[model samples]
Target: MTGHLHPLHEALERLDEAWGDADDAGQLSRRQLIAVTEALGLLHRRSGAMLAEVAACVAHESRTELGAASLAKEQGFRNAAQLIATTTGATAGDASRLVKVGEATAPRRNLLGEATPPKYPAAQQALAAGRLSAPAVAAIIALLDRVRLTLGATETAEAERLLVERAQGLSLDDVRRLVTRAEAWLDPDGVAPREQEQRDRTSLSIFERDGRIHLDGDFDAARGAPIVAAVNGYVSALFAAQKEQIDPEAPDAARRSVAALRAEALSVLCAHALGCEDEAPALAGASVVVRIDVSDLADGTGYATIDGSDLPISVSTARRLAAGGGVIPCVLGTDREILDYGRERRFFTRAQRLALAERDGGCAMCGLPPSMTRAHHIRWWKRDAGPTDLENGVLLCESCHHRIHDNDWEIRIEGTGRQSRVWFIPPPHVDPDRTPRLGGRARYDVVA
Candidate 1:
C-alpha cells in the first residue's frame, strides 16, 4: 500500500526469517541460541509498538461519542480492549496496557488542528525505536502522569526523559524501581498523603478454608515493612538449611516449599510475640532494618529503603520506624567482635548471637536467621565438654539441630571470628567419603 511494508508486517517477516524452525533450536550452538533470542525479542518489541498504535486507534474509533454505531459495537465487542484481546488472544489486562501506552505516546492534535508533541516524547521515541516494551512504557507513563500535576512542567519533562532513559536495557521490575524512586523525587510532598492512603486501605482477613486456616491481608509500606523483613529473613534461613539436606528423599528431610516455609515463619513470629508479652521475657531482636542517607535523615527529605523491598518509603516513615527501634540506627561495622565465654554460660548472650549472625549470616548448618536459631556447641556442652566460646558455638535451627544429632552429621568451624566459615560433614550413608560441604554465608555466594 506504500513505499515500504507496514511495520507490523515487516516485523512478522523478520521474525519468521530469523526464527526459522523451532525444532532446530536444540541443534544450535549456545552462541547462536542467544543471538536468536535477542533477534526475536527485538522483532517482538517492534510488533508490540505497532500493535499499541493500532489498539489506540481502535479505542478512538470505539469512543462512546459514536453511540450505538461505535466500532466495537459493530465488531460485537463491549469495548476496544475486549476487541483487541479477542482478536489477538491476549489478556484483557495486557490489551489495556497497550492502549494506555499508545495513547500516552501517540502524537496529538489540538482542537484547532495544530500538531503538538505527545504526553511523553522520550517514552514515545523509545517505544518507536523498539528499546522499551509496552509494559515498561505503560509503567513509566503511569508514574509520570500521576505526579505531573504536582511537578512543574520542566521537572515533569525531565523526569520523563530520565525514566525512559533508565528503563531501557532494564527488566520491567527494574523499571518499577526507577519509577518508585522517581515518584518520591518528583512529588516529595505527596509521599505522606499516599502513605496515609495505603494505611487507610490496610486490612486482614482470616477464615477456615477446607481443612486449614487461610489468611489474606494487605499492608502499607510503613506498617508492613517490618513484617515483610521478618518473614523473608526467616524464609531465607529455612532455604539455607534446606540447601544442606544430604537426603531430600529421607523420611524427615526439610522439604517444604517456600509458601509452606512462609506460613511456618508467620506462626513462629506470632508465637514469639506472645512469648514477649510475659514478664521477664527474653530480649527481642530487631525485626526490620531501614536504610536512609545521612543527609536525608537530617534534612527530612527524600526516601528510605527497607530491607527485602525495592519500594521507597517517605523519610517521615523511616524516622517513625527508627524511633520505634525497628530500624538499626547505626552500622556495627568491625568494632563489634565475637564474645567468648568458655563454659561460663549455658546460653549464648545477645551480644554473642549478634556476632554469630555476622559470621554465619544465620544458622551455621542452615541459613535460618539468628532469632529462630539456638547457639549450640560444635562440640556439645554436655556430651563433648564443649566450651560456650564463639569459636565452639554454632547456630542451628530446630530441624537442623535434630538432624545433626539424629543423623551423626558434624559441624566444623574453620578460621576465627568473622573470617570463620561453617562446614557440614555428611554421614557415611549420605556420602561415603564423608566430604565436608561449605555452609554459612559462603553458601549464598553468587558463583560465576
Candidate 2:
C-alpha cells in the first residue's frame, strides 16, 4: 500500500506544480480552470487526510506508554493541539484533526509544513486591543477556512495574506455586521432602491358643492396645523352659537345640525332689522328695489336722488344708511337727540348695498373677489323676513348665490361678540363629513 500511494502522491505533486506555473503566467482564465483545479484540489485533500490518519495512529501509541512505542512525545502533538486550539478558538475535535494532519504532513516533503499559515494572529490581537471585535475576527477566519477548502495550497496562502492586510483597522464585530447587511441585499424579495427613494419624497384642496363644502387635501404633520385650526374655528363658532339657542335637552343631531343653527341665526338678524321680534314684518305697503351706483349719498348731493331730493350724507354714513333701509326718515335733531318727522319711502338703498359689500365682501359661500360676488339675503325680502342689515345680508359670488337660492341651500350669520360669524350650508354630497358643512373663512383682509 505504501509503495502504490508514493507514486500517486508524487504524480499529484507534479500536477500541482504545473497548475501553479499556469496561474502565475496568467494563462489560465479563472472561470475555465476553476472546475478542473477544484477536482484536483479535492484529491489532494484526500491525500492529506490519509497522512492525518497515520499521524493519529502514531500519536495514540505515544500516549499509551505501556503499549506500542509512543510517537506523541517524538512529534510534540499535544503541544501543537493546545496551541492551535488556543490561537484559533477551534473546537477540541477540530483542533485534534488539524494537529493530526500537521503531524502526518510534516514528515512528507510538503509545503503545508512551511506555509506560514494565517492563524489570524493580527485579527486576534486587534480584538484583544479593542480595535477589532470578535465577530469581525470570526468573519476573517471563516473566509480563510473556505479558501483553504476550495483553493490550491498556494492560492489559499495568498488569500490569507491579502485578508490580514485589509483587516488592520476594522473591528471584528463591525466587519461582521457590515457583511450581514450586504448579504441581505442578495435577497430577491428585498425592497427596491427606487421604492425607498420615492418614500422619502412623499402635499395638502379647500372647494364647495350642492349646499356642502369639502376640504380634502394631504399635508405633512408639520403643515397640517393651520388647516385644522381653520376648520376647528368654524366648527367651534357654529357649535357655540347653537348651544345658546337650543335647550340642553335638544337632540344632539338637531343642536349640532349646521343647517338648523344657521336658519335660526338668520331669522334673529332679520327680526332685529325689521324692528320686529322673532320674525320679519310683511312689506304690504313698502316698495322694493335693488340697484348699485357709485355716488356720495351721505353728502346730500350725488348722481342719484333720494325722495326726489338731492341730499348727500358722508360716503361711510350714506353707505350705512342705504344698507339700513332704502328711505331715510327726516329727523330734526343733533347727533345725540332726534325728533322723527315721518316714514317717507321704503326701498333697498345704495347705502345698504354698499354696507353689504363692505361687510360681506364677496361670496359668503365662497370667498370670491368682490367684483365677481353679489349680495344675498338670508331671508327673501318678499317673504317679509329679510332685512337690508349687514347681519341679514351675505355676499356670495354669482355662481354660489345661484346655487344657494336656485338650489335651495341656506346661509346665515352665527355667533355673538368675538365669535360672531357668517357661513353657508351646502346641500348633501358636497361634504359627507358634516351636514351643511360650514363655509371657510371669509377672504376679505381684516384691516388692523
Candidate 3:
C-alpha cells in the first residue's frame, strides 16, 4: 500500500480495533446488539471490497496471462471453480461465481494496445469501494446479463449504476428486487418473453448423498419467488417457534442450522406435492421418530435425535417439526420405558388440500391466491391432536401462517358446510377485547 489507505479500508481497520475492545458487547440491550450487528456487517462489506480487489488480480494473472482454463486443467482440477473451491473451501457455486466476477470486473485492453473500459464499470467501482459483496456483484451480473441485449447498453449501464447505489446498505435479496424492477422497466415488451424464456429454463433435481438430500435447480421468477417465500417463511417460523419454546431463564439451546431447517422445509413441501398422487405413499408412515430422554423433553432444555441422523435438535424444534405432520416424538423414561408415543395421523391428505382450497378461498387471514397458501390445521393437529378433516383444515398463505403462530393469533371455523366461515381471533395486544374477525367477501349495500 503506497498511497494512504482507502477510506473504507481505514474505517474497517478502526472498526476492528474498536470491536476488539468491546469484549462485553454480548450483554448489550437488543437495540445495541442490533447496532453491533450492523457495524460488523459493514466491516464485512469493507472486507468484501478487498476481496474483490484481490480476486481481480488473481483473475487477471491466472486467466489472462497463464490461461486459467488450460492451467487449471494441467493442475489436475476439473476447472477454475474446482481450483478455487479446493483452496477456499467454498461450494462450487460460490467459487465459480467469484471466478466469473473477477473476470468480468478485471481490466481490459484492445488488440491495438488501447485501454478498454470494464464491462460493468459501476459494479467495479462499488466492489473496489467495499459497497458490494462478491455475491451481490454476481447477482447484479446475473440479472443484467439475462436481458442486456434487449435492454440496450445505455439502459443496462443505467440499471447497473442505480443498482450499485441501492445495494450499499441493502441485502442481496433487496438488490435482486431492485434489478428485477429495473429490468422490467427497461424492457416492457421483453418482460413476458424473458419470463417465458426463464420458464423454459426451469428445472429441479433431488438426490440422496450419505443420508442427506442434495437439491439443485434453477427457476424463473414466477416459480422461484414462491419457493423463496415458502423457505423464508418456514425458516422464520422455525426460529420463532424455538424462541417461544425457550424457558426464558436457562441457556438458550442452539437451533438447527439454517441449512438443516431449509432441508426440512423442503421435505415438508415434497410431502405436500407427493400427496397429490392417488396411490402416493403415506408420508406420515415414514415418520421422523425423535427419541428424547423424557427429562429433556419436559425441561425443554435438552436435545433429541431424529432417526437416521446423529444431529440432535432441541426439544423445542423437535416439537415444532412434529406439529401436525411427519415427525413422531417418542419420549422414554429413565429406565428407557416408553413414556409417550406421538400419534401418526397428522399431515393433511391431498384430497384434504383440494377440499380446503375450494372452501377457504385462499388464505383464511389474507386473500392471497390459493396457489400461494399452505394447508394449515386450524386446531393445530400436533398440539391439539386435531384430525386432518375439512372442518379443521384451511388454506393460509405462508406469511399469515407464520403470523398466526408467532403473533399468537387464533383461528377457528364457524358454522356448518356450505355456510361455514373461517375466522381469526386477534391477540389481546392486537385487539384489547380480542375481536373475532371473519373471512369472506364484504358486501356493502349501495342504492343505484
Candidate 4:
C-alpha cells in the first residue's frame, strides 16, 4: 500500500524542508526572510490543528486505559467516554483525565499490547523549561474539558487555534507563572478554589453590604470572642455587687430590674466616655457606683431620686435592686425619703468596666468586639418575672441579640447563688434535636 499526500500537506512539508535548509545554512536574503516568515505563520496555523488532533487522540486513548484498569480491578467498565475531573489541590481529577488520554493514544502492538506513546513536544518543552508547574498542566487539561463540552468538532478546532495562537512564544513555565500570579491577584482572600466550588454548589451567598454592616456575611466567631467576654465580665461584676445589697429571698423580677439598670448604666457610662472626648477625662477619675433600691418599698410610681435629682427608674432597674444589690440608705425620719446617704459608689466604675472588657474580651456567641456588642438582658423585665441580676444579663453581639429576642428565641439562666449561668437556644436549623446550649464560665472570677 502507498500513502498519498494532500495538496495542503505537500505544501506544508515543502515549506518545512526549506526552513530546515535555511537554518542549516545560517544565511538568508531580505526577500528569502520575508518568504520564510510568511511560511512560518502558515505553519503555526497548521501546527495548531496538529496539536488539537493529538489532544483528541490522547483523550480517546485515556478512556480505553481507564476501562481496562477498571475491568482488571473487577470494576464495571462502561463505554469508553472522555471526561476530566480533578482530585488533588484543586485539579486532581484533571491530572487523572490527562494521564488517561496519554495512555489511550499509546501505540498498539498486537504482540506487545501497547508501545511507547509520542511525546507532546510543546508541552514537554514547556515543562522541561520550568515554565509550567504540575498544577498549571492540570489546569490546561481542565480547560480542554471545558472546551470539549462547549464546542463541537469544528468549534473545538477553532478554540484550539485560539489557544495555540495565544500561547505563541511562551514556554510552559511562563504560562504557569502567569496563571499563578493571575489567580492570586484575583482571589487574595485565600479561599481555595475547590472550597469555593463547594460553596457555590451549596448556594451559600456570602456578600458584602453597603450600609449597616451585616454580621452574618462574615461568619467568623473566633475573631469576636474577646469582645463578648468583656461585656459579660462587666455585667457579672455589677450583678455581684447588687446581690450584696438585696435580701437573699427577694423576688426574681426586682433583682432582674436592678441588674438591668446597673448593666445599662455601666453601658451608658462606658459609651459616654468612649463616645465623647470630655467624658473620657471624667472616666479616668470616676469611681464605681453601686446603688440599691427596694422596689416594693418605693412608691408605685417606680421613680427614685439619685444625687438629689429625681430620676425616673424603670421597673427593670427597680426590680434588679429589690432582688439583689440593694444598698439601703439610713432614713433620717419616718418618711420614705432618704436622710443620710451611704458611700456613693458606682456599680460599673470606669476601672471596673475596662477591666471587665479586658477580661471577658468580646461577645461569647460570635466573638465580636465589645464595642460591637450590646449588653442584653437574658430575661426581659417587661415580662415581670425577669431579674436584672448579673446572672440574667449577657453580652451578645447586636446580631445575636436580635436573633435571640427579636426572633422569638429564648435565653436561659442556670447555676445557683452568686455565680449564675446563661445558655442560648439556637434556632431550629442550628441543631434541631439538641436543646439550647450554654457557654461561658459559671463564676465571675476575674483572672487578673
Candidate 5:
C-alpha cells in the first residue's frame, strides 16, 4: 500500500525485509521456509491476475478489425498472445491462457458504454484477492465457458462461484478433478458424446529413434484408465523389486528411474497382451476399478468414475468396462469371512490377497496402494515352510519385499484378522539393537 511503490513491489520489499535475502532461503527454519513459500505463491497468483488484465487490454488493441493499426502488427508480432509471450517470456500456451482469463475476468462495456460485471466474476474476484492461482482461474473459466451454452445464466454463475470456492487451497490436479466432476454433474447427457469424442481421438504412434523404440500416444479416459492403472501397478512392483538391491557398490544394484521403469512396464504390458505370459502373476496385477452409485447404475442417468482417472464416464460405458475380463467387479458392503488356507496352496489366493489388502492397506512398508502390492509369505514358503494362510502371509510391494529380504529384515504379526498389526524388525546392520518398526496400516496411521 506504499504510495510510490507498486503493490507487487511493495509486497516484494516487505517479503525481502521479513525473510532477508532469497539466497538464504535454505538457511531459514522449517516454519520460515513454509511461510515464505506461501507468501511467494500468493504474490505469484496476484501477479498472474495483473498480467492477465494487461494481456486482455493488449489483445483488444490488437484486434484483427484494426488491421494495419493493430498494436501487435505495429510491434511486428503475429498477434497479442505472441507479443505478450515474447514480452513476458511465457510459453505460447501460457500467454494464450492469460489472454483468455483476462478477457473473461475483465469488465465488459455495452454499446452505450455501460460497464458490466466480468464473464466469470467469481474467478476474477478470487484471482484479484490472490485466493486462486492463474492456472486454477483458467481451469474454472474454461469449464464455465464450455458449459455456458448448455446451462442457464443463474446455474452457470452458481457453478462458477462453487468451483472458485472449492478450488481455493487445492492443487491443480485436484482442481482438474473438481472441474471434471462438475462438468459431468452439469451436463450428464453430454457425457456419452464426450466419451465418444475422446475415443475417436485415441491414437498411438511407435517409431524407432536412435536405436530405441519411441512410443507416442494419446488415449481417452476410458481407454487410458486401464493402461495407466496397469503401468502404475507394474512400476510399483518394479520399484519394490528395485529396493531389494541395497548394496550400492554391488553389480546388480538397481538404479532405474520411474521413466525407465515405465518403459519396461509398457514393454511387459504389450508382451502380456500378446500371450507371452512367462512372467510371475504379480506383473499382471493391474485391474481397472470403476465405481458407480447403485441408483446411477439402475437409472442410467449419472456418471461413473474409473480409478486413476479424473474423467467421468456414462453408466453405459461403465457397464461395458465392468464386463471386461481384465476389469475386477468388486462389491462393497459385504460381510464375508476371511479365508485362510493353511499350507493347502503354495501361493496366496486372490481371497487371501483381498484380506491382506484390507489388513495392510497396500505395501505394508512403503504404503503403496492395494493394487500395487502383492501378498507374500512372512514365513518363507519353501525355506521356512510357512503356511499360505492369513497369519503367515503379508501384503508387500516388490520393493519392500526385496529390501526386507536383502537387508535381512523380519516381519511379525501381533494380532489376528482386521485387528492385526505388522512389524518389521531391523537387522543388526540397520539397528545395532534390532528394533521393531511398525509396519502395515498402523505404520502410516491410515486408520486413525
Candidate 6:
C-alpha cells in the first residue's frame, strides 16, 4: 500500500487482488469470461516477471555462501536446478527454464545492495510492460548475449529495441526471424563461423529402450531450419487426417495430442529422408532386415527377429515392414537355418513408386499428398506370397502406415481397373461386425 514498498510485494498484492476479482468465474457470462481470462493473463505475466526477478536474486545470493547454498546443500541438493526443483514443486526441466530465464533477464545489485540495471534492459522493460511473454524475453536475452560478442553494447541495445517492437506486433516466430535477420545483417561474416561452431556441437543419437525408438539430436540453424520445415509439412498432413477423423473446427477435440503428431512427423521425415536418392550411401540400402522362421511365415502367428536385435518384432509389424518402409526379408528354416535373403527383390522399385503415385493420388488411407505417403503392400509379401507390384501396393500416409503396423488393422486391394479400391478393416474391438471402409475419395466425383 506504501509508495516505498518492494515491487515483488506489490506484485503479489496485485495478483491476490486479481484472483479475488475473478472469484465468480463460473457465474460469469461467456463473453465476460473470455474478457476476464485475457485480463487475468496480463496480471499473471506481471506477477510472474516479479517472481522471476526474485528467483534471480535468490540464485545470485545462493552463488555466494551467504544464501540458499548451505541450506540447500544440507538438504542433499548438489545443484541450483535440483535445489529449485526440490523447494518448488516443479519438474527439473521447468526449474531449469525458470533459472535460465531469471539469470538472463532479471535485475541485479552490487555488494552494498544498491539497485542495478538488468543485463537485457529492453527485454526487462518489455516483460514488466506485459508486452513480451517469458519465452520471448528468454529468447531475446540468449540471442543478445551472442550478438553482444559481435556488436558493441550500443548496437546490441538497438537490436533489442527493434526485437521488442517486433515482439509486440508479431508472433514469436516473427521475433525469431527478426533476431536471425539482425544477426545476419550486423555480422554477415560471423554467421558461417557461428554456424560451424554450432554444427561442431551437433550430434544425433537413436536408441531403442522399453520397446520404443528414442531419438535425441542437436542441429545447427542452417541444418535445423529445413528439418523443422520438413517435420511441419508432415505434421500438417497428420493434423489434416485428424481433422477428417474428428472435428476440423475444434482441434482440441482431435483424438491425438500435438506430441503424438510431432512424433509421427519425425517418422515421416525419416521415411522421406530415406526415399531421397542423395542420402548417405550407408542408408541408401537401409532395408529393415526382418528374420522370420518358415513356420512363423506359414502359420502367421510368431515374432520376426529383426537384424541387429535379438528381441522379436510382432508378426503384424514384420508383415507391414516387409510390405512398407522397405525391408530385407531374411526367411529362416527350422533350427535357425537361413532359407532366403530377399534383397532389393522384395523392396518396391522406383518405377513402382511412380506407378503408386499415379494410382493412389496421395495417401490411400487419409488422402494426403503423394509425397506424404509410402507404398505399402496390401497383401503380405512374406506371408501371402504377395508380389512387389502395383496390384498389391497401396499408398498410405505415415500416421496410417503406423496405425496398420502398430494396431490390429487390416488393408486389402479389391476390384479391377477404375473400380479397383483399397479397403481398410478396423480391429474387432472397434466393430464386431468388422465392416470395411474404403481408403481415399471416390475415383469419380458424385454430385450431391
TM, every model = 0.68, 0.22, 0.45, 0.24, 0.71, 0.45
RMSD of each: 10.8, 37.4, 18.2, 29.4, 8.8, 19.8
Report the error of model 1 at residue 305, Å.
Answer: 2.5
**What does candidate 6's lDDT look like per residue over 200-222, in tens digits?**
89889999999988989887543
Q: Report how far off residue 246 is in candidate 3 (Å).
A: 26
Top-scoring candidate (TM-score)? 5
What lDDT does candidate 5 reach at residue 112?
Answer: 95
Off by over 4 Å in 3: 1-9, 24-35, 64-76, 112-116, 198-448
Per-residue accuracy of model 2 over 271-328 as CA lDDT, tens digit each: 5667855543222112212211333233432222122111112233334344654333
Assess each prediction's global lDDT (C-alpha) against the native.
0.73, 0.42, 0.60, 0.39, 0.77, 0.59
Candidates 3 and 4 compared: the better one by TM-score is 3
lDDT (10s digit) by residue, model 4, range 156-209: 444433343334444454344333323322222332332244334432243568
Model 1, span 1-448: residue lDDT tens? 4523365566666666666666678876554565577777777777788888889999999999998888999999999999999999999999998999889989999999999999889998898878998888998888888988888789889878877876777667656756776677677677777778888999999999789998999998767777766776666555444466633653331556767777877887788787976552122343565656677778887666554354567788888788886555423333345688778787777667666765665566656555566677888788888888888877777789999989999888888766677889998876678889777644532110
Residue 153 displacement (Å), model 2: 71
Better of 1 and 3 by TM-score: 1
List runs of model 6 lying over 4 Å from the truth.
Answer: 4-24, 65-81, 91-117, 169-182, 198-448
- Per-residue lDDT, model 4, residue 386, is 52
Q: Score residue 381 of candidate 2 by CA lDDT.
A: 58
| Model 6 weakest 10-residue run by lDDT | 439-448
The local lDDT score (0 to 100) that residue 284 gets in candidate 2 is 16
Candidate ranking (lDDT, best to worst): 5, 1, 3, 6, 2, 4
Tens-digit lDDT track for model 5 on 36-79?
A: 77778877888888889999999999999999999999999999
- Looking at candidate 6, what is the lDDT of residue 373? 59
Model 2, TM vs. native: 0.22
Q: What's the distance in Å from true for residue 286, model 1?
A: 7.6
